[model samples]
Target: MEKTTNLQETVHSPKDEGGTTLGLSLDKAWAPKTEEKAETEAGNDSTGDAPEENHDYVTGYKLALLLASVTTFFFLQMLDMSIISTAIPQITSDFHSLPDIGWYSGAYQLTSATLQPLTGRFYTRVRAKWVFLFFFFIFEVGSLICAVSKSSVMFIIGRAVAGLGGSGLQNGGLTVIAGAVPLESRPFYMAFMMAFGQLGLIVGPLIGGVFTQYVTWRWCFYINLPLGGVAGLFLALLHAPDQIKKPQVSFSLLRKVIPQLDLLGFAIFAPCAVMFLLALQFGSSDYPWNSSTVIGLFVGAGVAFPIFLYWEHRQGAEAMIPLSMVRQRYVWVSSIQFASLTTSVFVGGQFFPIYFQSVKGVGPTLSGVYMLPGILSGLLFVLISGSLATKVGYLLPWALFAGAGTAVSAGLISTWGPDTSTAKWVGYQILYGVRGCGLQAGVITLQNVLPPAQGALGIAFLIFCQNISTAVFSVVGNTIFTQSLVKQITALAPSVSPAAALAAGGSAEAVRALAPPGSPELAGVIQAFANSFDTVCYLLIAAASLSFVASWGFGWIDVRKKPEPGKGDV
Candidate 1:
């Protein structure tokens, strides 16, 4: 076992306050040292986190600040994802383009999802800190665009831009932790970051509701600017080492970097994914399922899907999502489990507002309150699950619990009506949130299975599945909700035109004004909306159920067992 002597080169920058180096030439930073391997096999370090090894990872006061900055940035990014939900009705009112509601979230998710793989490559080949800062800048710009947009098209474009930046925030968060901490302690830190994100995810709508009511919808986006500024300031002050390092920043490195991003694979994939989702989005609503536009999209996606797979297969090591990594049982299983569980969260977040606003006749602000229990509980469990997994050294129990619990809760949510008690909805959401807590633990398990070099890519692949499926199924949920609303309303309340109600700025106020609350007409509409929500609930139920099925594939690996030095960090 040979050792690394001078593979690392440190350079002091002007920003170094107390001798913290801004650049580390970490070509083989983690390359196994003969002495370190021996110490590891001998179990000398009682606590896995504080090994008697020096990799020059960010430490001391700097470590605390770095972790806080990343976690706060993540919280802001997540807040962006759901905060827009409460503002959607107001946005459509301002833009007078009610039909464009889907495009707002859709565009963001699309850009974030499609560009995710490339972000992975970027992190792996370049400095994680630089990649993160660049993406953060993009996200802030996108948020600014959203805040000032005067038209629907501009707003959608802004969302797309924000998503482009959002693609890297989570991946970057995980990458930074990987660089800074040992594998044994990563789950707790990662979970700590995720717990804050969960808080953001759970509370986003409520915050959006406050902005839409007291301030304005634009403020929801404008709020990101300040939070981003704070995070950026901290990150700028502390330029820590990256996980996969290049010798130095140069134009020569840029030449090699472009090809590594797999531009050709992305070209083939982006359009195909858009086409497939558009088909799902437009089918039976914008156009007949048999219409040429819809059919062409489906056919195009079907053909291109296989072509992209083949291209990726041939690309092998250079592929956007390395097939070698994808072939691993744990990697694929973790991806599926994470995607399904997360998709359910996204779908439920969107649908709950509809139920609260339209069926129960609550305002947007109140709806967010109704949602707080679930989000808070989910946040609590995220922290608990991460901490407990570290202590117990096992994660499979949580995985199984996530699948079974969320499924049951979703099914219960589907049965709710306008008259359903507050206790029931609160109870159901708590169930869903606690059950879903175990999902984040899967990422830790995934990193344990892959090779050392592929860590960022593995994280990116998981994010891609999550973003793509959430984007796809959000549209699907929209379609299902809309079709059901139209069909059910037309039958139950013949006097009312569902189109007119939706187009009346798509707000609860609009629908409620069509008839008095106690009238049979209003009752019929609420019932119809309630039923439509059930279909959307079914989508989540199915997604959560799939998590259970994927849980079985995780095998029986003990997460406490550290990966070999040349392999992964457990």
Candidate 2:
């Protein structure tokens, strides 16, 4: 086998030029001594046929079609993740299930996180198109299951199934892009795909809100059927290529890959994640932080993590997450920033509704409507930053500004009280929209920094970190809000019992029934909700501050770098 030398090349555009020219050169490592090998490989007739040496293959149109196909998959996957937020209240009501409400979301997240890295590796060992097509079908089946689900348990099972498939879409799309395109072109293409993904995030909530209000919440899951089916059919028909390498499914290959699957790590990691999230969900509402359940969860996660780390190290190359990648400074810093950004976003998503409904006296419908500005702004920024990254070759500045803006927005929102003006609240939401631009843009940056060999795995890890952080922070934010609300209500309504006030806070009708007209207890309830909002906002501000520090570590990488001759594959 001839070995190709890998060399890095950089491209620079003249200030006067409107666009940068990235030149790629492919050179044969060794001149062919015979024509028979090339002829056989090319599937040309061998009867007096000569093999073409050093043929340059270009498929601009085919690449475009493949990208479009992958983008559709990406959109559907991300949309499902956030779409349920607006329909949560409705879904819970319809099923008459509250005990496992969180599981509807948490189950999907947990399964996805646990299976992500495995899917990434699976892509390397399987044909990209086949693997994607198989998983796409799985996802569609899951969606259909959810659409017809009559029970909460059935719905959760559907979500779990969907999550298993959704985990593949992100990594699978990237795998296809990596296989189809040259190394230097990836960032630009990645930005394009990310824009679509962000669009799904933006549209998901709005669509869910609309469906829940006007049509039916079931439509939210049903809608994915047509969109996903079209994308999958396109992939199966036009995008599937014969040129891509298929994995050798030998017993030896299975032995190597199966051990690398890290089933033990997943066993430890998944339960820890579930326990931690459960503890977060139940700690303040159902059990105290110091209670046996909460403490045991914390202790279990703490013990499992170090052991998991040691196991990863011991497994070395066979580990699901390689120790070397985890130890990289860029990886850790980027993961922290990504995780923190997600934490802020999730916290905001969870409580902003409460702020609108409880403190600002907006109805659920209106509150969902008010959230549109921030979501739309974030979508716009995702596109802007992605485009900008292609041109500017750096994302740190945008990350820094976004982090600072998020902190400022959170700080401003934290000051809200019963008397706060609606204009100020709307203004705060706009600031949040601006802040979201940075967070979404930062994802492309982190994905760009890792080596191409680890592209899928790296992307999965980034997402995993984000999900874990979001789950944990959501729990913490809830705890903070509940504690602050309780404290404030108790202090203000010394005459009214804490238990009575809590009972009132549980439902709007209960609160109205318990409090007499213009009573001190009613006033106390209002004050308590406001104080809780303020506390959660302050915590978000702190998270944003940490995001700023993490942004600094996003080392600059020039996306315009010229492709070295004969070094097309990364």
Candidate 3:
């Protein structure tokens, strides 16, 4: 039976002395102690650093189970994001809709990027366990829809729904750690979790290739059902410690949900992103950059941008990007670093596989193999960075090293040619990924600076920037790749229409069939693919360079040096 107690979760800014919480649930043994929070807050100093009592880390057997469960889901979530890469060409062939290819990836990112901040807020207000499971179920349902999709439209809808659900997993996972893990030891667990999550990115292509070539393209989505079920079971068994907020429940909590989550601000903000990204899509494809449709979308995004900002300003602390919290130097700067690094990473994600398949003439299965050097190197460094950060008591150096190192690597990558030796390509990937330390740059900095009360929202905002960067830059890369292909094919293979050569049915095997090796058409098409990747890599260089600049903002602050139990530290 539902209790008649008050049910409120008051999320306050860092400057607030202490947060208030109210809930309507049967008294549970593990619920956060309200009295302990007030006592700790009264004893804490001016910097708003969390007291020792506030670091309620779940330890021993529960910690092990929690980490394992989180790792499993992280793998599934990333697998869901990436498995489609190798299978997209076949998927397009089955549905006979080349124009819809962008939607397959874009729709997922759209819902993910736009909706995550509110999900972050939800984490703060409600029971995080329930919220995490809710999104997990949503993700499973979306995957089921995709597996059964018979038309391109159905697949696109499924992708959008999956994006909405999968958006919460990564952010939610990090939020769990920030709340439950002590600051003194947060880096290792955070980094370890992230390192494990990245494993999915490495093997995703191989699994997708095996499924698509040996079975059916639908198996790519089908794999998630079984894996996600296992992860969900594990997540259910563990009682993950969360932020010290009263448990929210009952019909009153339902009534307060809209305002609590800032749905109105999201309504204004989501359209801005949709319209802006649509403009990029339209201008990049058959439509000219100057086309009326593209211009209108751009103008609409422009107008909405200011309106959204103004709305957030009016909403203050509850807004998607809280003005007071983000205004802090460390939070804003780290966000920039995160966006640039994530953009650079995704630029490679979007275009490098194309570099292997189309330019090198490697088949889908082999192309995945070729991308491994980078993924492995990146994964290795994530673990190393985490351990080093924990041991050395500094995070800025790693962030700076990754930022500076990746700029040099991305610059090197932009120079590849169609006949570039295997040695150069593999080395470039290692060079790019050796800077994997960049992955930990943004979130660790955030967890250190924000109060525990703002933990979920801060993480949500940081990832919101990253999701937006990846989504926007993916469209930008597609624009570069498509436009460059059109221009190069026209100039180099004037007799071969770019449309036919770039078609789903016309890729790889068709190119070899229509224009055998040593033929002028084959040479032109391969060179076009080579030149297109080089253009896209320039964007990668720019993004990496910007990340390097943002890295300087991390400064020399020691992440592990928490203040005395009653003292403030900033």
Give per-model TM-scores.
Answer: 0.87, 0.78, 0.87
Best model per lDDT? 1
Runs in model 2 with CA error above 4 Å? Answer: 1-61, 91-104, 133-161, 240-256, 436-449, 489-524, 563-570
Query: Per-residue lDDT of 1-570 in model 3, one digit per residue for the tens?
Result: 221110121111122144422211112211244323322332223343333323357888888888888878888887887677777766766776555666778778878898878887777766576778789888888999999998988998999899899778888888776656667678899888889888888888888777877898788899989888888898887777775543445567656564566788889988998889888777866578899999999999999999998998787665767776677666788888988898888767766666776677766677778878888999999999988886776666788888887888888888998888889989988988867887887788777655556667778888888888887887787777777878998988787877765664313564554465688877887887788779988888888888888887766556664334334544
Expressed as tens digits, the lDDT of each residue in 1-570 for candidate 2 is 441222112222233254533221112211242222222322222353432221122367877788899899998887886677666656755665433445666667666666766675565445567778778888888898998898888998898788777767776776676666554555667767876777776777778777877888788899999998888888876644322334444566566556546788777767766666667777756788789998998888788888888887776644677665566555677778877876777677766755665655554456667677777776676667767766776666777877888888889988988898878877887787655555544445434444334445566677777666665665567667667766887787666655555444322333444456589777777777778778988878988888888887765545554444566654
Residue clash pairs of candidate 3: 8-22
- In candidate 3, stretches whose alpha carbon ends up further than 4 angstroms from where it belongs are 1-55, 96-99, 248-251, 505-507, 561-570
Superposed on all Cα atoms, the candidates' RMSDs to the truth, in angstroms, are: 9.7, 7.9, 8.1
Model 2 weakest 10-residue run by lDDT: 22-31
107-164: candidate 1 lDDT, tens digit per residue: 8888899889888878777778878989999999999999999888899899999999
Ranking by lDDT: 1, 3, 2
* Model 2 RMSD vs true structure: 7.9
Q: Tell me the deviation in Å of residue 7 in model 3.
A: 24
lDDT of 1: 0.78
